[model samples]
Target chain A: MIASGYLISVIAAMGIVTFALRALPFVAARWLQRHALVQALGQFLPLAIMTLLLVHSATGAALAHAGWPWPELLAVALVVVLQWTRRNALLSIVLGTCLYVLMRNFLV
Target chain B: MNDSNDPAHGPQRLSVLSLSAPVAMGYVPLGIVFGFLFVQAGASWWLAVLASLLVYAGAAQYMMIPMLAAGLSVGTIALATLIVNSRHVFYGLSLLDALPRRRLLRWYIVFALTDETYSVLTTIAATTSDRQKLLVALLNHCWWVLGTLIGALIGAQAQVALAGLDFVLAALFAVLTVEQWRTKKSAAPLWFALGAYALAYGVAAKHALLLSIVLSLVAGMLWQAKSAASGEVQR
Candidate 1:
């Protein structure tokens, strides 16, 4: 009985967050789509958000230190190279991840 | 790169068909990490699989597993999920403009707003055929769903490591970073994040980091307008 209660709660909680995030955009976007300012923001938001996200995402492993995690930095450099040269998403992720794992274990 | 053939700022239609293969390629390994962590959190495969299928927010789902396993309240999990995924709100702001006004696509677009999908779909110049973009979005959702399901199912097959799995999100972000740098004409994201992080750290004192993301988005928009105006004046 207790376990089932927990299960129900988890599912319900998950449902709400998932549903809310999905629904908010539809409502917000429809109303905001025709606005000049909103459209302009949308245009530039991608570049800004992507940059913030990159910095946001890389908050793992190493920090604002230099030479401490040269391997990780080098792997990131490779990811940048792959992204720039080929624009291949999956390939860069795979290569960057593999390089990091190998470097973390072997080099470090 | 040609001015006449520029794909950016192009008129687009809802893309037909799904880009499942590409989406899958991106999601599988990443989802494996989510599954591995779910197991590490002491949750059974059933719980993790169901959440991955239904909830489907990669970062938060992973975060939820540990909290849920710890017997935390549903509200707690939900709140954490909201915080981790608050950025999704901003992601929707831009892409929603091009979204199909129809019923089904709207629902799917909202549901499929994963970071990877948003990054890929948003860059195809606004004018890319909407049919293609819709297909790409649908395919991207399938890839993530399938990846999560497969990863959770594979839980018992072998030992799964959670230690390094956290890095997948970072890696995915790195991929997005490269994407933005290559195609876009602006460096706003990089500068926004740095400036926002600094501002957030300075003013927040003890507030959530999410405030920074929101403020940064607003500041970024304002900064873009100012820069464009300056360029026009200089020209």
Candidate 2:
């Protein structure tokens, strides 16, 4: 088992970092609002960041299994399409995850 | 505040509950997965609960599990968390005026500004009361912690061998990505992200996410400059 002391320290550090990031804009709202670049990035970064996260996590999952990344690709595609058409977050996640688990368990 | 029977208060309370209900749906299951994986990876169940209660950022929490298991340094994990959650820095930009003005409520809202919370706060009517906004954040946090507690207990008891269960995180990211895409003003960021990831992966597979994030930041700056220059020309 991981040491509680070490784990607690890690948690504390992560919490501090996360809180700092989240509070940065609120603390610096005047400066952030004043800058055109900040506005541009505010428009630009969210989509980029979310897409990177999706790709990175999906890639990580694909690498965990051998051979083709077909399962990851298919499942992610289903999720994107389902979410796009239905606009239901829970449905898309549940169905996509269930399909991925099924393929990983039975097919390979 | 104590008047649940007051007709005016009832709908307002219901609206807050309705708003947070969807977030609960996502957070609970995702929190469960995080808890189960952390315990199954050898951390104590309560530590999983602690991480959920403390860290509260879903993606970073999920990413930390394998790193912690690998005995990576705390500094390394912190840097990775920063990269994974860098997007949050921008989340508050849009909510500067919308968030509560009081010290405690404001800070608590800031601390609880997960992707789901941010999206919900942004979509809710601007007339929403400060107390109601706090309720939404508080309720979402509670759902996440409750889910982690339940899952950690389950994980401590039995060892279920299941493959691809952790794919829930990726699925969650997919859902968030779709939502982001729907509200996108231009498609350039999407293309930029794809190219950046491909380039970063080719250069260093292990640091692809970090490198790609850096690349995208630089790209966003350059893209802004270009657009600004063209607007100057038009003017």
Candidate 3:
């Protein structure tokens, strides 16, 4: 089991970081609005960060197991396509994950 | 926007429920998955509930599972959380005026601002009362925590380990990335991110995520400068 003390600390740190990010614009609305760079980063960062997270996590998962990353690639692609077409997050995640679990258990 | 024929408290309560109902649909199952995966990662169940209660951001909470499993430093996880949640900074910009004025209510609403909550608040009738808005946030929050509790309990009961179940995290990120892509003005960020990740991986596989994020930040600034200069030239 993961150490509870360490886990608590991580949770606390994450909570602080998330709250700070959410609260920043409210606390500094004027400053944020005046800065063109802020707007630029705002427009530029979200998609990039999300894409990186997806790629990084998928790569991490792919590396953890042996053999080709077909399962990883297929599942992620299925999720992306489902999300893009249906616009339903829960459906995409559930179906993609279910497909992945099935592949890892039976197919491989 | 006519509320003239509407009854006072009942209809308002119904509307709040209706506004939050869709959010509940998404949060409950997603929260359950987060809690279950987190527990399956070997942390205690209550911590998952605590995360859902406190961190409240779905993607960051999901992202934390593997980091915690790998025993990443709090600093690294915190940095990752900051990067993952930075979009929330922009979320509050559009909500500055709409939030309740009372300090307690306003701050609570601010604290509870998930993507779904933000969308619901933004789309709700402008005439929505501050209290009803609070209810929407509160109800959504409850759904998330409740789902976490349920899933954690279920996870605790299940002893058989299933391979690849943790891939839910990737699927969640994929879904989020696709949504972000849909709203994107240009696909340059996607390509830029992939390129940065590839370079970062080559430089240091262990620190790839952090290095890539730093690279992406630098690239974002340069991209913005280039676009701004181009606009000037066009003028």
Model 1 segments more than 4 A misplaced: A1-30, A40-50, A63-67, B1-19, B57-110, B113-142, B156-165, B198-211, B214-218, B224-235
Q: Write the per-residue lDDT of candidate 3 for residues B159-219, one digit (tens) a residue.
A: 7768888888889889888888888899899999999999999999998989999999998
What DockQ does each listed candidate score? 0.35, 0.69, 0.82
Candidates arranged by DockQ, highest first:
3, 2, 1
- A best-first ranking of the candidates according to their lDDT comes to 3, 2, 1
What ranges in model 3 sit over 4 Å off? B1-6
> lDDT of each structure?
0.64, 0.88, 0.90
* Residue range A1-108, candidate 1, lDDT tens digits: 126567667867876787686577667766665555555565555555555555544543555224486755687788888878888877887788788777766566
Residue B71 in model 2: lDDT: 83
Q: Between prediction 2 and prediction 3, which has the larger DockQ? A: 3
lDDT of 3: 0.90
Looking only at chain A, give the TM-score of model 1 against the true structure.
0.62
Docking class of 1: acceptable
Which prediction has the highest lDDT against the true structure? Answer: 3
